[model samples]
Target: MKDSTQGTSPGPGTPLPDSILIVGGGVFGLSTALALAARHSGKITLVESSPTIPNPHGSSIDTSRIVRADYAKAAYATLAESALEKWRNTDWGREGRYTQSGLVLVSSGDQFGKDYVRESYENVKAINPDAVEALPTRRDVERAAPGYGSGLHVSGGYVNWGSGWADAEASVAFARKKVEETGRVNFRTGDVKRVISEDTGSAAAAARRKVTGVELADNTIITADLVILATGAWTGRLVDLRGRAEATGQALAYIRISDEEQAKLANMPTVLNLSTGMFIIPPRNNLLKIARHAYGYRNPQRVPSPADSGSNPTQTRETTIEVSLPEKDVPIPQEGEDACRVALKEMLPAFADRPFVKTRVCWYTDTPKGDFIITHHPQYNGLFLATGGSGHGFKFLPVLGDKVVDAIQGRLVPELQKLWAWPESPPAAAPPPPSSSSPDTVVWTEDGSRSGPKGMILMDELAKGGWKRSSSKL
Candidate 1:
């Protein structure tokens, strides 16, 4: 996690564009802005559609998100370990923003969760063997957290005391404040309509054409030599990520617990059952949160083909393409609610039937392998993509931006470069269900971390509630 530009002059490479514009202001956008302003003296402008930095509708605005270096892949595990050190010792995690509540990653059946957790355990064990304890059975899990209700589904897992959860909204706000304090980045609020571009040569040249700027929803134009799309779930709408990324809505629900109940479960570590993709974080302020990390619901919409959106009319005909985009302020579908209920029944039986105080469908910019797309666009020149959090990017906020800046400057370590590069031939997206015509571009994250059914439509599932569901925990 060394700052690549901290010591030396700019390396020999194409000079960075004098003016840089960033779209979207979630973890990726703000963090990238923070790093750029810190290391570069160029003009940096960050444009977010929302009036504020932490858009309430954004996925990163949740109450809590797991912050751990226990990743199945050695690369992410290594990178997350560096980020963890910052969270533990730096001001980035000050003021109640981070809590070392510990994490219990478990799995019951012979699904991918078993292998994933095993791989993750070995990885974390390497980082800090002293902080990681292996749980060999359901009883071991119970002993670690006596507060859990009986009949837990965990067969085996591990507890990493060094891991914790981050106050997502607070951390994001901290990033914004830091970026503002730099007094280097200019902030703007605008709804970007499309990337402003023109055909430089023949029709074939459209793929390599450079975007001079972006056009806003209000017909306002913000010109820049470079445009970085940090847009999260909405990224598919702005770029032709036909097979690279899509938006998936994960379910999250909160229950209000009495002071007594909160006290009873005070310091219990977060429990995650990868076999079922359900997780329950200990209560804070008498509020308990239950969520899933599965192949979430989709809300696909048709939009003008991004490749041709701002190109010459004659060079390319205006055509529509379907991309899974975020549907905001939406309630969890009945399917998701049922899953949450099951998870509650197993984790905290006392509150199994309690009504949820609030529920939300958190959106993620998912990639096929659950990798973040942090490299330059393969077809579009002068454009870079920093989206594709794939449900795990928030933990890297402390150092992710510096890594992104490194990538932009052509000096990122070789390992991350390979992980974030555009797929040469991305796997064909899983086809839509027979009954529906989902966006052919919809890519359900097939990373071993995901569980539950795939290709579920949000509206369709909402309309068909009360269906039979697995009575086990979420």
Candidate 2:
């Protein structure tokens, strides 16, 4: 975390090691591969757990994800604006992949919610004055998007026509095709058992571990000069990110709407309520989606302590640690369904009683400040991390790789270098790490954009099942 921000062009790759292995084929992984293949001549291999490029279980493979430059943080807002340009001007946004349906961010009068909406208005207005409108009351919000029920639980908000949503699956497929055209990257499929490492010194005595490669679940080993761990939510299985990052499940439900209903709401702006952590995008293809963007549920599982990550490790070798991993291809639990159902009642009274045709528990790799971890391990050489999407990484799909490559080569801009670097100390928003050897801690993100229930366990909620339907589709 040196002063890499000064005197560096945040440009393309700089010919990394002769062999580079990127783990996971999701947003961060595929995008990184596409960028690397374009700039580097060395051998580059991309490995994925799923045979297909758009893994159905991945968080990035959803129907739609918000793409907005309306962020309270100026840095992310500016970066998102740059990405919006690509989604608007380049082929990256073609073929129904990107839709500028606009977005209205409303809040329920809480201090944090109000402050977040207010600052986001200021930032996005500065970025695009033509499409910005400030709604200072609930009536004003209803006026901005008449499709939304007039009885919304918001005090004030703003609408940014500059923002939009992206087709997550299509964009990932597009990225994969782009990488394949390069013909410089080798693709492999395997579930990584663990990252293999070698250390000159003992586990103690301040030893530095070098990751040679990864060992697959079938015991197949692949060696490389550099290994980029962009495994998204599953990164904790290969690295000890107890306090820094972990997987949290967010709830979403899709309902069937008639053609007439779809036409009426299809082009309406997306509405997100910060206080309740709920939102709804316009219906498409006779399907409407509602989701909660809150502090999500954690599904804790016992896993072997991952690599040291050059960070200090107190645990002895060959030990098991319980961390939150993804419960893929599973339906969201009763509590989440209830939350979404209640929000539907408030936001769209017409669809409040309709049964959800599908429900999903999308997982997010959350960090304390919602900042992505995209730098070399502070303690391990040849081990780089590009994860911690925290539910907002999809919009950056167009340009995430270029920035990642820049950071890899130490040419990233000064501002981004500071934001993406490995934390020297525990973040203020991060829960305090467990004092004992037990790695039991809750990661409550206080980035001011999240709300709703906290500390709900995934299994516990599923056990108390009360779905409108007997079985829910994945």
Candidate 3:
């Protein structure tokens, strides 16, 4: 019953609270808030600037593709294995959840494309040797889909039964529904200006300078014992807590397909074009979603409010839905679409004339490396950093939430550390933890001391941005 929305410090040995505040309400944010709600019971509250789950300018809600367990990294494989099960089991009956449509990799023979085939094939083979196989020739691929007979070129790489898609928007709605019923969370429509931390000193200050609460853009202040800033693309907007703003931008698109073509390719599975750096996903209600593998697009740092989308009720949902092609200055590129059309035509050529129906965009928050950044701020003891998802975070949202929970609890997560640690930039040459003499515990300085690792070499790789942490309130 503490004003769970407002901040108040714990005095002396007085027990600190279990109540928490969750910011943002997107898929990851909602899922994290709901998972933490289930984990901590009625001890969480969610603050959202939008009235609903899918922010119009946000990522598409219709996608159902999940990369599954064929990931190259051991951590990713294990996490995907668990997430696949959760998606299958309905994880407590959340609708528009996971469906195993499997994933297909297509290539016309470029270095990156070949690399994708090799990597995906290697990963799949290591796990289930029989899961991946190469198609013999273009004729064989054409046999798989009537359309591919002429237009599609086949390098023939694919992972069967491992990858799939999910209803992203529905997933968000489901998670929100689950957490909404908890009665501990109240979804208020207000923008978060900053996450204010309490001031505390010394080791005993564990209960001291932790996140006190958040301030809304309206000037109304809300506080809590703990705060989780899960806002997506706008994550850095929360606070400048010791260099946590490190956010990047990314974008995604959806291609329009004919109703008949959509149905034909509906079962076509998620296909990655290694050569073109494009991916085609079969989404809900019959649509093919296309996106690029790289990031660094023209998406701005801040998304406009609902009003900016001309999203007024009279404006209509169709009016709010918008799309932008890969190159900002150029006209929407038809080359990617042409590639997809040709490939799909080869696979099932019934509709070469069918043009891309619609398009939309979304962002990815990236770290210096493509890995996630989930840790505590060294200087700001109370705040935990959970941004930097790059592009691959969606498939691992649940596990990521669990890791965030571990960080909030202040316990070292061994498995998580491998993925989250900035090994190259060990925490600034500050005094070592009390017990450990050697600073073997790697840390990254905001000044770029710990940017990457040995295996994770830098390639001037595109920095795509992506969001959310969790809470403990009802």
Candidate 4:
């Protein structure tokens, strides 16, 4: 792999072609579109399957997402640090969109020897010593945030005052507005069927193909000089990622905090249990968002539509029924609810009995090592990919678009180039076959014992060991 610092290969240069089409208007697509519109004098068109820019099912679309630079890896830590700078300086940071409440990391053991929390603390400290502060014991953690060390055994950890949270959905909307004002970028709402390609000759026939543009579900064929697949989670449905990525749906729950509890926990920072991959966002609008950062459940039944079927390949249709809307029919599964409950009970017991105002099965396009893929297609010319958020991409919202632009221009730094490059071959363990039942008909389950919306138990019903019907709103 070539070093990205050497800059993109000598070719068309940073100036993009006149017509550029981006499929999937999530974080990756919008950010890249905005960057391109600012840099290149061209008409950039973005196709979003959903009705709006921030597709409600997109990993980028959410109420609140953590923004922290305490990464176990130095490269990501550096990127996050740069992203934080932009978050604080840009409009996205101001206007009450970003909250710098700091971040707390809790570990089950000492701050050394293979502990993720310790590694993160050490890495962040390496960048800026003052940015990280050690909490030597559970008492130290509780002292920093009252009742934070209640049920959990917090041996030691650290707090990065530089970290905080962002309103993800709002941030995306703001970016969309900025790009729209430029007039160079046009937002088109429709499901992309597939990348329209053409065979040039015998040389291009055997191996290489040129992507001309994309065809929509309505059979509207829009041509372009370049086509970028920024479809998060649904990338596999559009292109063969060679087992590099797969969509895994993780669980997220919003617990309604009482006025008293909200006031008491108002100052609490975003808390992360590095060992368990569980984290809690600060209270906002009387709701506390709790989620996990693990390899979540694969939707075994929701298979991607065949590319030749003339159907939307972005999985937008399935997502709309499964998650895009606030419909009460979407089930979060008992396992998801229990996972949040267990983590919260151990970390913040006071809020364990709070009612779950809402629950969601957020999806992520996961990679094996959690590194993002931001390279061009090996077999198809004029085709590029910017997917693979791997659950942690939201935090890098401020600067991720520029990186994608760098990737498109082949100007990625050496470290990032090697990290984001496509693998020569697929992994040893083959990815599961892309076959599943219909997303609408499939039943969500927890350990395969019980299923349906009822399995997503309410907090008040947890003690009774039975389902308790409740409204799905605060």
- Model 4 agreement with the true structure over 288-392: per-residue lDDT tens digits: 888876646554323344332212222334341132111222446676788889888987887787778898867777776677889887777788888878777
- Give the clashing residue pairs of candidate 4, or none: 4-412, 8-410, 301-436, 301-437
Q: Residue 14 lDDT in model 4?
A: 57
Q: Which sequence of candidate numbers ranks them by lDDT, best first? A: 2, 1, 4, 3
What TM-score does model 2 achieve against the real structure? 0.92
Query: Residue 399 in candidate 2 has what lDDT?
Result: 86
**221-329 per-residue lDDT for model 3 (tens digits):** 8777666666655664444312222332233444566577666666656666555545556655765555555433322222322321111212213222111111111
Candidate 1: stretches off by over 4 Å: 1-14, 201-207, 309-315, 431-436, 465-474
1-474 per-residue lDDT for model 1 (tens digits): 233223223464456779999998999999899989977888999999999879878889988899998889888887887888899999977897888889999998676689999999998898789999999988999887678867578798999999888889999999999999999999999899998876668677735677788999999999888889999999877777777888899999999999999988768898999999999987788889999999998877788887653223334656788888888776788888899999988988888999999999999999999999888876666788898999999999988998888888887777688788888765786677787666566688877899898788876786676422232121
Residue 411 accuracy (lDDT) in model 1: 70
Specify the highest-TM-score model's number.
1
RMSD of each: 4.4, 4.0, 13.1, 7.2
Per-prediction tally of clashes? 1, 3, 40, 4
Ten contiguous residues with the weakest lDDT in model 1: 1-10
Q: Give the range where candidate 2 is weakest over 10 consecutive residues by summed lDDT.
A: 430-439
Q: Global lDDT of each model? A: 0.84, 0.85, 0.51, 0.70
lDDT of 2 by residue, 1-474 (tens): 122223457354454888999999999999899889887889999999999989888988878999999888888888888889999999999999999999999988764578888889988888789999999898999998999877698888999998989888899999999999989999999999888777646655355678789999999999999999999999989987877888999999999999999999989999998888899988768989999989888878888777454344444577777888888667888788888889888889999999999998899999888999999987777889999999999999988998888888887887887888887765444333343232345577778998876677777778777433224342
